[model samples]
Target chain A: MKILVLMKMVPDIVEELEVASDGRSLDQEYLRFIVNERDEYALEQALLLKDGLGATVTVVAPDAPEVDDVLYTARAKGADRLIKVTGLPAGSGARATAAALAVTLPAIEGALPADLVLSGCQAIDDLDGFVAPLLAGALGVPYLGLVSRVSVDAAAGKAQVMKEFAGGVMGRFEVSLPALLGIQGCEKPPRYVPVAKVRAAIGAGGIEAVEASAGTAVAPVEVAALAKPEAAGHAEMLEGSAQDVAEKVADILAARGLL
Target chain B: MAGNVWIVAESWKGSISDATYEALALGRELADGLGVRLEAVLLGHGARAAAASLGRADGVLYVDHPALADGVGEETSRALAALAAARGPGLILVPTTNVSWDLLGLLPARLEAPLVNFCREAVVSGGGVEFTSLLYGGKMAATVGAGAGPVVVAVLPGVRPAEAGKGGAAPAVEEVVADFVVGGGVRWLEYEEPEAGDVDITQQDFLVAVGRGISNEANVEVAEELAAALGGAVCGSRPVIDQGWLPLVRQVGKSGATVKPRFYVAAGISGAPEHTEGMKDAELIVAVNMDPSAPIFSVAHYGIVEDATDVLEALAEAVRKRKG
Candidate 1:
């Protein structure tokens, strides 16, 4: 089985976000980029699947010199090959990315026909949480989203996916081969890849290129004008000595039945 | 006028969601911008009553049936598609929720319209709407344009406050029937409500959020104590929600309800932006963390570099003394 993990580069949220002069856009100058949080899990999940099934793992992402480190990181995590698609815009939304992939997937099929595709449920940046299904539609393959568990049967050409619903509900689904899946969490936190392995992969790079859709234009749903949220109301300092504070806290907890 | 603004009201188990009102408010804004009528297409049981209360919109069309008491994705697509054709609107808005997320992409496919998922903002331009969405994980804003046809947008819940509608008398409830079919692949097994704590934080004007810095689940007592003393609610970070320590509804973040309380105090929360965005609209932000480097301080109007357990104890005592 061959698996592909789709990754998107996003701005690091730890950094402060500056609104554009118009207050409708983000100021790019203050932006620092990293792999989207959910996409990181997607890549990690793909690598785990590769290890479990003795299959190959491939990563496809927008090509940028800055993202060379990102592709290397994927290789360190267990991807066998990395394919880069050029001319995709930075910080593009799910519709644009899915639309582009819908066009690009056919070109790469000759070298690597992906048996399965994986992505994070939602990227931390956009968090619209719709890309996985949209990509599945573009690929004309059965897909599942918000998956907590996934398994593949290479012989039967089938895959079982367990998805998450509200209030701790779980739904199980089965789909045939050449399908797409989105994963949410891990029983174990993702394994971190060492920088040394990533550097080695980059040095030995044999990167391949692919085509992407000419970008489509998006319409505004509303103009986003951001203001820093107002300050919280005054907190009355808990009075008295340390013991008094603790006692008051305990009494309050007991009254609330928290104690 | 450019086009009628349309809202797809979502329903589950025969009842509509509170976010539906937020979507209507957003739709009304779009419609007002274009100087066109704002219309809503409600699909599900009791939809007519919910539609009746939305006096803010131009009109409300209902597609009520027993089949909709349970969630029906495919049927919703048919109803929305038919409504779009009849309305001939320039833009359509739907609440971004679990059900809507499942049905969002299908609408564009069904109506042959351009669908933009999770729109954060929009502006009317040249009879079309230009929308802004945070892409690549909230790092940068991506702007897109829809062509001449209706631009369908799914909006994140809790982004805007509910507002009064300015057009056509509260929408008259009218039922529309269609050849709608529910996909049979999935069936309802059972329903169990999450174990909700005694308090609903969303209803609280005062909220005390405990972060990882709190000593342990046991130390949640200190936070809860503070909540009790102040007559507020106790909330937690993703870990608390993920651990099932609290109901999923109580979680505050990008996926959870965007909240705006009069007073929001953070104890030990390092305040990841993912977490902060949910409470950014709060009236006041008081952050108490031992680590001065914690990100919560940046957004906090008042910051105290002290342990959360200690601050919570102190604040709780102080409030109690004041009340006594």
Candidate 2:
């Protein structure tokens, strides 16, 4: 089996975000980028499939310094190949990125004959989670979102997947091979690769670059402004030690007949 | 076509969802500002009746078909794409639900139209609409707009209050029969419900909700002990449930159970919009978090800047001493 994982690099949310002076986008000078958390889960799901079915895993991501780290880490963790798409602008919308991938993925040498394509269900910055479905549409394949588990019947040429619905409902479905799935998570947490193996892989140095053509996929959405949320303006902050605050809470609960 | 706004009414189990009404309320405002007719599109088994009850729209375009009962992605996307191609509304508003993700994604790709999701507010400006949405897990807000063409938006639920439609008479209902086939390669199977938990947090009048601030599964007991002292139920945010510290049924968020308790105590939750959407309606809210800038403090009536574990133990001890 051949599986293609669409990966993304996003700004780490741990550091504070500031709106640029233009008031339409994030300030990039202080931004630090890392692999999106869900994409990590997608990589893990692909690796699990590889372990079970001896599938070959190929990863494709937009070009960034952090992308190199992710590619090296994935290689150390058993990914067979990595293709980095370059020349795309930073903070491109999901649709534009997916359009570029549609043009680039099939053209990558030895990347065709893919049996399945996997991506994270959503990214933290996109207006909506549109990449996987858009990519599926571009590829003219069936698409499913919020998938948690997947199993394949290679001989039968079909796969059974567990699709999650709202309110904790899970549905099982059988889809044809070569379909796209937007992975929410896997049964197991993403496997961890030690620093030494990643370092060695980085030193080995087999990163391939693919130049993405400028497509007609333009970002329909524009940023009018960015701002902080308004304060609630009604909270009465308690000041004191934990004990003092606890006692105060107890009194209030008692007065309200809650204790 | 260039001056009209359209709302795709969402329904479940043969009844319109609250999200549909919320979209209609916002649709009314957008329609008024643009001086255009606001039309609603309904697709289901009993869509005509549901469309009549909307009352706020100037007209309704409905497709009543048995195959549309479940709102499957492939069928619905094809049908909606055909409709949009024929009657090009300036803006299409859809509620941000599980199904909307599929429809919004496919319809835009099919038509190559601009789309946005998780929108909390929208306004007519610059010959288009400007949408305000939360980003970076609700850490910051961004306002986005599309150029003068067909744009699709999925409005977040619970962001706007539902208003009664102009309620005088039923609007014109036009039946549309599109040549879209259902059931491509995927089939709908039975839904597997989550395992039942020991306590149903929805029925409780008081709740102590723990978030990632509790740190680990072991610290969940601290929140439970505090809940026991207060004679309330224990629940948590998505991270706790995702970590297997609590059952899925005990989670409180947009994707989980929506609860309206008389009193709510939130510990360690940073108040992402997804988590707060389910519990922000509580009669009284108290928050305890080490971060003073946490968004939960904004919605909380009482705020405590301390470690949740420390606060939990102290509160439990205080309750015990008072009872003794």
Candidate 3:
């Protein structure tokens, strides 16, 4: 089985995110990016499948700041191929990224078409977890998302995937190969790869790059302004013992007739 | 963008979802603003009878098909696309949900239309709809201008009240029969309910929502005692549920249950956006954590910087004393 994992970098929320002076985009100065939380989980899932059923794992990503480090880390973590697609329209939303990937992925040289594609259900930046399904639509394949568990029967050209629904409902689905899934999580926590291993992967020669052909035509919504949500209220710090805070909370609740 | 405003009415497990009504409430205002009709596209199997509940919509486009029951994105998007292609809607609003999130991605690609996702609000501006979406979870909000074409907006929860969309004259129902062709691949097999049943956290009046700060399974008893004293139930953030400290039903987060109880006591949660999305609207929030900079304080009405267990124990005592 050949599995392709799509990953990307998003603003690290721990650092304060600032709106650009233009007010339409995020301020890039003094910003940091981390591998999207769930995409790392998708890579872990693909690697687990590789360890069990012997599949070749390829990590694909749209070009972004510090993405090369994320790609090298994926290789260190057992991904077999790393291909970065560049020249995507800067400042595009997740929809454009998905559209561009749909158009550009199939055109990459030496990267065989994948039987199954896995990507984080959504990025922290866009919070639009539709990349897998959008790409699948363009590729004319079936897609399932919010998947947590997966097992492939390569001989039969089929896969069994477990999806998560609201209220913790788990729906199992069977899909033919050449499918894509937006992974919500893996069966296990993502394994940590030491920095030494990632450095070795970089020494082994960094990732391959694919130039996005000019004028990829996915119409993206233009952000007119960006700002932090107005803080509704701040906590009135109830200091002293727990009983003091609890007493104050209970009094507040009682005042509101909730007690 | 020059037609009626349409909302994809989401029905699941044989009933209309609250999120659907919420979208309807928003759609009604947008339609009125645009001086066009508000329509609902209801797709389900044997679910056509529920159309009467969608009276806020000016018209109901109900389509019943066995394939529509499972909410497979391709089938749903195809069915909606076929109908929209024929009837030219100026704006479409879909609630961003598990049932419809897949199509939020698929429909835009197939229609070649721009999708505004994570959308929180939309208003009439310059004779067009401009949207505001919460990006990077909820840290940053972006205003999106609708370009010169029909656009689909995925409305977020908590924008408009579902109550406003509940009562209206029965809408005219038009049964739509459209072709829903899909790749013969993905098929829903079985559904596993969460750990039989515990408590429907969504219905709770008071919630003691613990996070990773609780530490271990044994510590859950501390929360239970606190909840008992407060005459409420115990719930947790995703980490506590993922750790098996609480059942999935007791989880309060984006993927779990959204709760706006009368009183919420948060402990040890760093307030990730996913978790905050579910419970930020609680009537009153009291947070306890050691970290001074924990984001939970941002939404909390009261806070105590202390160990969760120590605080929980004291809170229980205080509540017990107050009740006694």
DockQ metric for all predictions: 0.14, 0.62, 0.59
Q: Which 10 consecutive positions of candidate 3 chain B have the poorest summed lDDT?
A: B238-247
**Candidate 2 TM-score to native:** 0.93
True contacts recovered per prediction:
0.09, 0.71, 0.77
For B203-295, candidate 1 gives per-residue lDDT tens digits of 788788987677577888777888887788888776565444555567676445566787788887776655776786777677777765455
Best by DockQ: 2
Ranking by DockQ: 2, 3, 1
lDDT of 3 by residue, B1-324 (tens): 589999998887778888899899999999999899999999888888889999999999998888888877768888888888888898889988777777787787677777788887888877888888877756777888868656888888766878988889888999989875855487888888888557788888889989988777787888899898877899998767655677677878766888989889998887766687689889888999887666688889888899998888887887787788
Could you tell which candidate, 1 or 2, scores higher by DockQ?
A: 2
Candidate 3's TM-score reads 0.90
- Can you give the TM-score per candidate against the true fold? 0.72, 0.93, 0.90
How well is each residue in A1-259 modelled by candidate 1, as lDDT tens digits? Answer: 8888887777665566676687655677877777766677777777777778878888888864367788888887788888888877665656677777777767676533688888777665443225676676666665656665677788988777666554344555666778777767544446777888878888888667777865342432333443332323333344445456445544544454533
Candidate 2, B1-324: lDDT as tens digits: 265899988876567777788888898989988889999899887657887777889889998887776676666778887888888888888887665656766778877888877787888876567788877777777787777657888787775666553353788899998667676566556677887756778888989999989898888999888788778889998778767788767888755777889889999898877788788889888899888777788889899999998988998899988987
DockQ value of candidate 2: 0.62
Task: Point out the higher-scoring one by lDDT: 1 or 2.
Answer: 2
